[model samples]
Target: MSDSSFRILIIGVLIACSLTHVRSDASDHRYKVGDVVPLYANKVGPFHNPSETYRYFDLPFCSPDGIIKEKREALGEVLNGDRLVSAPYKLNFRDEKDSAVACRKKLSEQDVAQFRSAVEKDFYFQMYYDDLPIWGFIGKVDKEGKTHPNEYKYFLYKHIQFDILYNKDRVIEISARMDPHSLVDLTEDKEVDVEFMYSVKWKETDTPFEKRMEKYSLSSSLPHHLEIHWFSIINSCVTVLLLTGFLATILMRVLKNDFVKYAQDEEAADDQEETGWKYIHGDVFRFPKYKSLFAAALGSGSQLFTLTVFIFMLALVGVFYPYNRGALFTALVVIYALTSGIAGYTAASFYCQLEGTNWVRNLLLTGCLFCGPLFLTFCFLNTVAIAYNATAALPFGTIVVIVLIWTLVTSPLLVLGGIAGKNSKAEFQAPCRTTKYPREIPPLPWYRSAIPQMAMAGFLPFSAIYIELYYIFASVWGHRIYTIYSILFIVFIILLIVTAFITVALTYFQLAAEDHEWWWRSFLCGGSTGAFIYAYCLYYYYARSDMSGFMQTSFFFGYMACICYGFFLMLGTVGFRASLLFVRHIYRSIKCE
Candidate 1:
C-alpha cells in the first residue's frame, strides 16, 4: 500500500477499536459481587450525621498484601492502620422496611409487618470507609470492649462471620450505628466485639447518632501462617542462612583447588594473578554498537518507562475522573504517547554521543518506535470509540482540550528546552575500558548454569497464576471492570516468592552447574524472569484472548511497551549479578594466589 493509504488504513483500524472501546460496559469492568460485603472501616466517622453513607467498592487489584502496603509505600502515610479492610462484612439491599418511610404510624398493618420482616432478614453489607473500599482488612471490637451480639457490632469476618440472615422480601438498611467500647468487658483477653453506638434518641432528643471507633486486629500473630503473607517475610532470613551455608561449602573447595583453567595454558598449579574487582571501566558507557541505533533504543526505553510510570502513579492517586477506575483507557493512551517523546530524545542523544553517527535518522527511528505507534493506536481508538457509541470516551471538547495542552503547553516547552540541551557526548558517559586484546568468552551451558536456571524458575510460578494474569491484562485493554484486588494481591505475592526463590536457587544452581563460570551465569540465571513475563503476555493475547479489533491493534504496541519494560528489568538484574560474580571471582582468585 502507498504511504498515505497505509496511514489511512491504520486510521480506519483505530476508529473501529474506538467504537468497541466506547461500547465497553463500565459497570462490568468494575469489581464483581462474587464475594463482597459492605463495612465502614476507612471512613469511620458518621460523627453526628444520622444520614447513611453508601458507596460501591470495586475489588480489582484486591489482594491482602496490596491492601496492607499500597498506601503505606506510596502515600508515606497509612491512615487506618488499625482498621481491617475486608469484604463480606455485611451487604444491605433495600427492602420494604429499609427507610423511615416504613416506620410511620400511617402504615397499614400489612405494611408494618412486611417492613419489620424485611428489617429482620439478613443481607450482606459492603464497607466504605472513605472514598476507597476495603478488599481484605475487616474491623472488630477491641479486646477490652464489651461483647455485643451480631446486632451492635459491625464486623468484617476473615473466614466466616455471624450476621443477620437475609430475606429478600424485607427491607434492611445495611447501615451502622456508631457506639462506644462499653466498659462491661473489663477483663482482658476476652473475645469482645467492637461496638457501634447509634446516634438515635428517644423521640429524637439531643445529639445525632453517637459515633465512636476502634479497629479489630487480633492479638494473636500467625508465625506459621502459610496463608497470611508476613510468613514469607521472615522466611527470607532462613533462605539467606541456607544459601550462606551451601555457598560456604563450595567456596572452601573451590579455593583449595589449584584451578585456574580459563586463565591458563594447562597451568593447573600456576599461581593465579592477584587482582581486585575491576569493571571494564573505560568503555563501560560506550554505546553497544558504537552506533546510534542502540543508543536511541536505550534512550527511548528510558523515556517511555518514566512517562508511563508517571501517568500510572497519577492514576493510582485518583487524579483522573471517576478515580483510578475510570482512567485506564485514557491512561493507556496518554502513557504510551507521552513516552514517545522520552524515547526519541534519549535514543537520539545517546546514539549521537556513542556512534558520532547521523542524528536525524536516530531521532526519527526513536520517535517511530516510541511516539509514532502511540499516535496511530490512540487515533484509532478515538475513532472506534466514537463509532461504537462509547460516550464515556473523550468527547470532541475533551479532544480539543487534549490538543491544546499537547501543542501549546507541552510542545512549546519541549522545543525551547531542546535548544539548550546538554552536549551530546556529555549526555552519555563513555565506557571506561576498550579491549586491547580480544578475549574469547565461552557461552555458559544454558540449562546447566545457575543464573539461567534461576531465571527459568520464574516460569512455574508465573504458570501457577497465569490464568489470573491473563484476566488482568484483558481487563485493562479490553476495558472491562477489573475488580478483584484481593486475589490479585495473592498473585502478586506468589510472583514475588517465585522470582526470589528462583533467583536464590539459581545462585547456587549456576555455581553447581559449573564452578568457575558461576559469575556471569549466576546473574543471568536469577534475573531473566522478565523474559518469562514477556512470553506470558504474548501467550495471553495470542492463545487466550480474542479481543476487539481496536484492542487488537492497540495490543501489540501496548505489549511492546511491556516488553521493553521487561527487557530493562532483566538487564538490570543481569548486570547486578554479573557485577557481584565478577567481584567474587577476583576476590577468591587473589586469595588463593
Candidate 2:
C-alpha cells in the first residue's frame, strides 16, 4: 500500500477500535424480570499474593458440562488476569432462591489434598454476576482446635450466600457471604461427600444505578487515607512553592545583576577576562554527544508526558472507575500505542536540529526506546507466570494481538511522524556563536560535581511524591483500590513543578561552575528521581507490604522497573526542556558578541 493509504487504514482502524467499548450485555443494564443473569467465575489465588492467580476450575471445582464456555474479554481484562467463565449456578434477574445445591461430588484423595493446600494458603475466589464483582475465601484456618491447645484446623467453605442489591431493573451491588455452618473439615483421610450449595437473595435498594460504586469508594478507612493524601499534597505544594521562590530570587536578583554588569563591560570595551557562566557562552549551547539518543529520550518522554495527562484526565472524568476491571490498563495500552507518533516527531525533529544524519536509525531508536525494555521485562515476567501456571500469564493469542498492534499501528505512525519531522527539520537556534575549540571545564568541589548535583536535584522531586507513592504501591501491589485521581492529578503537577525548578536551579549552578557539559547532566539530574523511586520500591516491598513468593516478587520488580524507567524518561525530559529554556532565556538576555 502507498504511504497515504496505509496512514488512512491505520487511522480508520484506530477509530473503529476506540469506538468499541467492553463487549458486555450489562452496557444497557436495564433488564426485565426472569432475564438470564450470567454468572462468571473469574480467578482463584492466595489472598496475600494478588499477582498469582489461577483459573477457577484449576482447583477441583465441580464442572457444569463437557466444555465450559469462556466469555470474551477486552485486552485490559485479559492483561489483568481475569478469566471469566460460565459458572454452574443459574439465576435470573430478581429471581431469589432460598437454597440450591450447585453441584455434588465425592472428593478424591487428590481433590482433598488440593483443597487442603488451598485452604491452608487462604485462597480466595472471585466471581461476577450482572457486572458486579464478589469475592469469597475458599476455606479458613482455625488456630484453636478442639483436639489440642495450639493445634490448627482447616475447613472448606462449602456454602455461598449471595446478597445482590438491585434498584428497579439494574443490579446495584453484590456480595458473597460464606456460611460458617456449612464448613467441612479437611482433616479426614477418607473421601468426603462435598455438596457445593449457594443461596441468592435479591434485595431492593433506593440507591441509583449511577451511585452503585460509591460503596466501594466510601470504605470506613478511605476518609482517613484521603486526609493523609491531602496533607501530603499540601506538603508537596509548599515544597514546590519554596523551590520556585529560590529560582525566582536567582533569576531576578543574581542573573539580572550579572547581565547588567556584562552589558556595561561590553559597552566600555573592557575585555578583562570573563568569569562564571558569562565566559562559557560559546560552548553552553553546543549540541551534546549522542545526539540521536538524547533526541530519542526527549521524544519518548514527550509521548509519556502526554499519555500521563490524558489518562489522568480520563480518570478524573470517571471514565475509569475502581469497580471497572481493566479499564485503566486498557486505556493506557491503547493511548500509548496511538501516541507513538508524538515520540517519533519530537525525537526526529530534535535530532535533525542537532545536525544528525541518521534519520532511519533515530526513528527506529525512538520507537523502541521505551517499548524495548518494557517488552523484554514483560516477556520474562510472563515466562515466570507461565511456569507457575498463573492466570497473570498472557494467553498466546493475547501476546500475538499486542505484537500485531505494535507492529502495524505503532510502527507505521512512528515512521510517518519521523518522515514529517525530518522533512520539516530546522537548524539549532543558539543565541551565542560557538568557538572552534571547546572551553576547558574548571575543577569543582565534591558537592558541585555531577553525582552530588544529581542527588540534590532528584531528592527534592522524589520527596514531593514519596508519600503518594505509598498509596500507588498499595493500590497496584496490595488489595487496596485507588480512586482519588483528583489528588493524584494534584501531586502529579506538583512533582513536575518541583522537578523543573530543581533541575533548572542545578543547571544554573553547573553553568556558574563553568561546566559546559550541562546537557546530559540536566537530563540525568531530572532522571535521577527514578533511582530514588526504585529505592522506595525496595523499602516498600521489604517493610511496607507482605508480598512474597517468586512470582509476585518478579512481577512486582519487573513492572516497577518499567514504571521507574518511564519516570526517568518523563522527568528527565521535563528537566532537559526546562534547562534548555532557561539557558536560551539567559543567553538571549545578555550581549554575547
Candidate 3:
C-alpha cells in the first residue's frame, strides 16, 4: 500500500462519482401505472384555444372518473311497461353494461352551475391509464358546436359512467351526482375500462366524500374500498421469537451439563481488566466459544429483513413508487450509498462495543462496500440508457439533478443517522466477558467448520420460498404487471415463520456437534440459500421462459442485484457474530485463570 496507489484509488472514486451526477440530473419524472406520481399541473398548450372547444357544464365530477354518458331514450315513442333496475352503487367499470346496471339519480338545473364551476376551478389530474387519455369538463356547447368557456349542461344524476382509474391514485375529495339518470345514448358495445386514467384533485364545485355519500349513506352502498393490512410487523415478531426461543432452549440445555458448566466457570476469569465499560468490552474481542455467535448472526439477519420491509412500505406510501418516472429509480440508485451509513453505524458500533481495535477500518468497510459498487453500476446504466432509449431510460439532465439531490439531501441524512447510531452505544450487552486465551485446542475436522453449518442452515428455507421470490422478481425484472398486495401479505407472513425456525435449528445442530465458529456460519448458513434460489432461476429459464437476447441479459443483471443484496445480508450476519465471538473469546481467555 504505497501513497500513489491510495491516491489513485481516491481519484478513481471521485471520477466515478462525478460521472454519475452529470448523468442523473437531466430528467423529469416519467410515470407509469403503480407509481404514486402526483397530479401534475395541466399544460396550457392543448387548451390554449383561440376558438373555444365545446365545454359541458353542470356535469358530475364524481361520475366514474372518465367517459361521458347521457340518458338513452327508451326506443322512443314505444309504450312504457317494463321497469329498469339500476345497480346498487357505482364503480369504475369496463364496458357500458359493466359501469353500472342503470342510472338512478335525479339532477337539478341549479346543481349544475355549482358543480361545473368547482370542476373548472380547482380539480387537477394524474394520468393513470397510459393507453388512452381522459378529459373532464364543466361548461356548455355554444352555437358554433364549440364548448363555451362557461356554460352549463342541464342533466340529472345516474348518467352513463366508466371506471378510468386502475393502479393510480383516486380523488381524495370531489363531488358527482351519484345515482344520476342517463341522458346520452352510449349503447352496449362501446366498452370503457375502469382504471383511473388520471389522478383527480378537489376544487370549488367539488363535493367531499361526506356529502357525496350523504344521499346514499343511508343504505350500505357498494363498499367504497377495501382496507389493506400488512402482516410484516407480526411476521417480524414471529421471526424474532422463533429464532430466540430456539437459541434459549439450546442454551438452557447446554448450561445443564456438568462439564459445560465447569468449563464456563473456568473461562469466566477473562473480565479482570477493570478500567471501565470500555475495558470490559475490549476483553470480548475474540471468537466466541459458546452460543454467542448465533446471537449476533440472528441480529444481523433481522436487520436485513427489516430493511426490505421499510423500503417497500415507503414505496406503497408514495415515497418510492416503482414508476416514479425515474425519480424513484434514481433514489434507489443512490440509496445503497446511504445504506452504507446504516451498515457502518450498526456494524462498527456493535463491534466497537466489543472493544475491538481498528475502529477506523471497521467504519470504513461499513460505509463503502455496497455504496461504492452501486454508484459504479448505476453510472454504467445511465451511460447505456443515454446511448439507447431503453424502456428503463432516464434523461441525462434528470440524472444530474438526481445526483445533486442524493449528494445534498441523502448524504447528510445518512451521516447524521450514522453519528446518532454511534453515540447510542451497543443495543445488546455481551452475555459474558471473553476468555484470556483460546479454549483448549479442539481437534474438530475442517468439514465441521462454520461454512458447512451455515450452508445447511440456509438451504431449506430458501428452497421453500424460492418460487414466490421468483414470481416477485419477474414482476420487477421481467416488466410484468403485478399489483397484488393481498397475496404478498400472506407470503411475507409465511416466510418469516419458515426462515426463523430453519436458522435456529441449523445453528443448534452445529453447536451440538461442538463447532465453535457458529457466529459467521450461523447467519450465512441461512442466508446463502439465496444463491441456490438464483440457481433455481437459471433452471426456470431453461425450462419455462422463452426470453431472448436483451431479456436474457437483463435477467442476468436483475439476478445479480438480488445476489449482491443477499450477499450483504449474509455477510452482515457473519460480521455481527464474528464481532461477538471475538469479544467472547478474549473475555474467556483473560478470566479463565
List runs of model 1 lying over 4 Å from the truth. Answer: 1-287, 304-323, 327-349, 376-424, 427-433, 436-531, 534-593
**Rank list by TM-score:** 2, 3, 1
* Residue range 1-593, candidate 3, lDDT tens digits: 23543354344334323322211113232333344322111111012110111112112333332344431212110011111111122323221233333222233443444433333332222122221222333222223453664332332122323333222222222233222333321112222222112212222234442232233222212232112112333444455566657656765575345335445545685543423122323233254442323333333343344445544554444342222222333333444333434454555455545554455554444444444555676666545533433323344554566568557644554454445555767645545645565443245677666666556655645544554565555554443333444445555555545554555555544444544454565456545656666666676566645443442345356536655465546544643454345434433433332
Give each model a TM-score: 0.41, 0.95, 0.48
lDDT (C-alpha, whole model) for all candidates: 0.38, 0.85, 0.40
Better of 2 and 3 by TM-score: 2
Q: Who wins the TM-score comparison?
A: 2
Model 2 superposed RMSD (Cα): 2.8
The candidate 1 region of ten consecutive residues with least summed lDDT is 71-80
Clashes of 2: 0
Greater-lDDT candidate between 1 and 3: 3
Could you give candidate 2's per-residue lDDT for residues 1-593 as a string of tens digits? 23663465456435434633453454588779998877889999988888999999999888656357899888888988998898878778888789998888888888888998898888999888777778999998888636772367778999998888899998889898999999888865568889899999999999999888777776523778878988999899889888899789876798988988898888887757788898999999888999999999999999899788877867787766665747777777777877788788889889999999998999999988999999999989999999999999999999999999899878988887788788875778799999888988888899988789888988999999999998888888877778888888999999998888899888988898899999999999989999899999999999998878999999988999999999999999999999999999999988886
Evaluate model 2: give its TM-score. Answer: 0.95
